[model samples]
Structures are given as structure tokens and as C-alpha cells.
Target: MPHRSSTLNRRLVRYAFATLFAALSTQAAWAASFDCGQAKQPDERAICASRQLSEMDVEMAVRYDTLTGLVAMGTRGDMQDEQRAWLHERAACRGDRRCLRASYTKRIDTLKREYDQLKSRGPF
Candidate 1:
């Protein structure tokens, strides 16, 4: 009985260590997702940055859709052009994987221009 108990204890310790290691590795991967700017390898950096941007793109798309719908219903026009510009920029960014950084910057510039235009049109 004592030998059996010792074996069981060993197994439990092994399992616990395994679980801890797995959890740590998972946390590391998640941390990698946020360390985009600190990635050393080009591919790694690109992947990390893409993951971050992809998340932003999804959120921006949702907001853009909602705002555009409001504009269509004449409930609001403040975000119409702004959302359109964002969509355009996101599209541009998604289309070219090689120039993701540049595309993002261009998208920002486009959004700024659209915002300026919308502002000139006066308040909605």
C-alpha cells in the first residue's frame, strides 16, 4: 500500500508539472501576440503585428458597419465618411501582406483626409 501511494504521488506530481508547463507556454504565446513591436524575426514580427491589427480591423469593421447603418437611416452622418475611409484602409491593408505597416499608415492618412472633408461639410 505504501509503494502504491508513492507511485500515485509521483504521477500526480508529473501531471501537475505538465499542466503548469502547458499553461506557461500558452501564456507565452498570448504574450507574443501583444509583443508585436518587440519581435526580433521578420516573420514573427509580421505575424504578431498582423494578429494585433486583425483584431483592430474586426472591431473597426463592426463600429463602421454600425455607424454606416446609422448614416443610411439619417440618424447620424458624423461617422459615415470616417467609417468608409477606415474600411478602405482596412481593405488596403488586408490586400497587401508585404506592406502591412505602410498600408496601415496610408489608411490613417486616408481617414484623416476623410475626417477633414466631413468636418468641412459642417456638423451633422
Candidate 2:
């Protein structure tokens, strides 16, 4: 009975790990925030085509969303406005991978700095 229970537990653990791996593999394989199939703009198409750009877009989006949630309403509004402006800047890059990479790097840096500032302000 103990042997059977242990074997069952091991199987459960393996199944859990396999599930997690599949989900992560799928995400990593296509990490863009937007649907690659529906990608219309040249910039969007470039992001979907390149693994690195897709990952960066996902990272930047996560950071922006998280930071916006944490900040005050006024700050959140400003962030949203800035984000709209930044999208235009990104769109301007079009199919230029180097430009897109630089744009994502800059935006990610800005978000990280803001996050650090917010973290420094509290025990929460």
C-alpha cells in the first residue's frame, strides 16, 4: 500500500512537471503579447518573427502592466499616455530589428526604474 502510494505520488509529480514544461515551452516558442497570426503592422510582424523581440515585448508589457497597477491613479494615467506615445515610437521602427531591440530596451529600463522606486517606498 505504501509502495503504491509512493508510486502514485511520483507519477503525479512527473505529470505536474510535464504540464508545466509544456506550458512554458509553448510560451517560450511564441512569447509575443499579440497574436502572431493576426499581426498586421510591420513592427508587429517583426516581433512575431523574432524570438528575442517577442520575449522582450512580453517582458516590457508585463513590467508596464505591473507598474501601472502599483502606482497612484494620476501616475497610472501618465504611464498610459507615455505608453501610447511609446507604441508610436516602436511602430516607427517598422521591420528594423535593431531599432525594435533598442526601443524595447529603453522602455524596459524605464519600467524597471519606476518599479524599483515603488518598491523602495514601502513594506508591502
Candidate 3:
């Protein structure tokens, strides 16, 4: 009876780990699918676009935090211009949330164009 119980316990542990691994793998796949440029299906494209918007929101928030930090550090003149440009780019990339929610492809394209323009303008 003890031997049978031990075997069952081991099996249960194995099953638990397997379940956890599967869940993690699925999450990773979902994240990978959320890259707007990598979607192959229409549904996937929409999902990717939504994910991109969410990511842009997070990025903008981070840029705002950085701007605040720079201000705290007494950034001035050209430094201020650079930081302001960075903030502008972040805001542009964020685009219109309503439009993004209504149409993912257009919003993604807008973001990509804004990002490219920012990159061409040099670093902040």
C-alpha cells in the first residue's frame, strides 16, 4: 500500500510539473504571436496590433519616467531638447488609442512610421 502511494505521489508530481511547463510554453507562444510584424493570420494580426498598442503605452509611461528623472538631475539646453524630442516620439508612437482599438493594422503602421522617423532624427 505504501509503495503504491509513493508511486501515485511521484506521478502526481510529474503531472503537476508537466502542466506547469505546458502553461508556460503556451504563454511564451502567445507573447511571440503578439509581435505585429510576425503575425501570419488575420486574427493573429489583430491580436498582435493590440499587443503592440499595449506595449507602446508601457513604453510611453517609461519614457515619461525617464523625462522626470532627467528633470530631477537638472538637465538643460540641448539635453532638454533631446529629452523633449524623445517624449514627442513616444507620444507619436502611442498614436490614437481609439483608432488603434478600432483598427490594428493602421495603428501599427502609424507606430512603425513614427518609430522610423524618430530613429532617423538621431538619439535623445
Best by lDDT: 2
The 10-residue segment of model 2 with minimum total lDDT is 23-32
Tens-digit lDDT string for candidate 2 (1-124): 9999999999999999999889778845565987888899999999998989998999999999989998899999999999999999999999999999999999999999999999999977
Per-residue CA lDDT of candidate 1, range 10-112, in tens? 9999999998789666534334323555756544445455555544444444544544553445534656655556546544544355565555556545545
- TM accuracy, model 1: 0.32
Candidate 3 local accuracy as lDDT?
0.51
Instruction: Identify the runs in model 1 with alpha carbons over 4 angstroms from their true place.
Output: 1-52, 55-98
Q: Estimate each model's TM-score.
A: 0.32, 0.83, 0.25
- How far out, in Å, is residue 16 in model 3? 0.6
> In terms of TM-score, which candidate is strongest?
2
Instruction: Give the Cα error of residue 3 in candidate 1, in Å.
Output: 65
